[model samples]
Target: MTSGLVSPKRPRNLAERLVGEFTREIRQARLRPGDRLPTEAQVVRRFGVSRTVVREALSQLQAAGLVETRHGIGTFVTMNRRDSGLRADAAEIATVVDLLAMLEMRIGVESEAAAIAARRRTDEHLERMRAALDEFERLLGAGETTEPADFRFHSTIAAATGNRYFASFMGSLGTKAIPRAHLKLPDLPSLHHRDYLASVNREHEDIFNAIAREDADGARAAMRTHIGNGRERLKLRQESSDNLEPRRKK
Candidate 1:
């Protein structure tokens, strides 16, 4: 197994880094099917991460169907390197540039998805979306990142489209689809974090409200605006970073 410590330079969170490392090992055949992963303590020691981070990474691997944890035994690789249909690698999508590209793609895809959802969504679907938005607001108020709730809101929208493929596509992307999950938002000013997320939740409200009204065109436009704003935010952040680099080097 690769023993290199996870790099702090990456913007990804500890669990995401761990997931990427283990994923690379599994995909590279360094860890073959049925090969047991390091015990939780061993992983914690080797990676210099908390037990929580390790468990979260392992849970993601299990959810991806790449590994399985046996009762009282250990987590073992469940599959070899093979094409898993409709998957995006977290590592590939880690950078701001990559995230921008993803947002562009989402604008095209999810915009239509929202329109379809507006037409097809049942009362149950609207309730779930409202619940997700409520959870997101609660988390934001608690000063939590709210990525899970954010993802849940988008996933619920996809599910409301009444198309399994749309839901599957969102599931495949997972919480990584939420830009702030990888953006290191804590490094920014607290005001920026709070203000930006509040803006985002308001966008979520727009999307949800449009869908609830069964206004297909309005839902599509709102989804586009939401995702398009995300792309613009990434571009602005990148420009800000680039402008700061010269000052830092001076």
Candidate 2:
């Protein structure tokens, strides 16, 4: 039997890494509902990580409804495991409504993030965002998935907010914040896919420019427009898929 829990290479964010492993175990049924996870010490030792990492991972699991922690007791898998953490839930967000709702959340959270990043970002933050963007474009040129670079771009903005909470929230969402990472429908034609990705890169460039110029309002507006446009594209694609379904029956 295959275990979905893979040890993260170069685990920079131990908490999120642990979250993925434990989430994988739960979703794979290796850690079933009502099963108490290993003690914090055991988890640290077993994973060769820290207690803080274990606790943070458990906290995120509780937030995601995958686990529950009882005082002086232990953390147990909850019956409400609707997802295998955030990233894996990408495959499950198949409907336009779900995609739109996720975008709505992003608009509220990331618009402010971008605005703050514009006002507060340092040279280092700007450099990181630029690097991520460059890598995203290069990966696209190679026809590779741009999810990691795309996510890093957004996370850098969140980090630039100078608020750990913003960064942590983005980290918890993982790659699910990237609309293209989820919203799986029928594939766009090759030309359309290339154009779509290019448009997304252009949007990223707009955000980068606004932040670089220290235009807070411009940054916020750009982020909103980017997310809103992505939502509209998903809606159109979903409608197209629905339309094709009726024709396929005929």
The estimated TM-scores of all candidates read 0.65, 0.62
* Cα TM-score of candidate 2: 0.62
Which tens-of-lDDT digit does each residue in 1-250 have in candidate 2?
1111212233335566787898889878999989999999999888898664565566556545667666579889976545432232333434446557878888888899899999999998898789878988997899877766777788779878877556666656665566555434566798889889989999999999999999999999999999989888866776666432211111
TM-score of 1: 0.65
Q: lDDT scores for all predictions? A: 0.74, 0.73
What C-alpha lDDT, on a 0 to 100 scale, does residue 87 get in candidate 1? Answer: 52
Off by over 4 Å in 1: 1-87, 243-250
For residue 156, what is the lDDT in candidate 1? 75
In model 2, which regions exceed 4 Å deviation? 1-19, 22-95, 243-250
TM-score top scorer = 1
Q: Pick the candidate with the highest lDDT.
A: 1
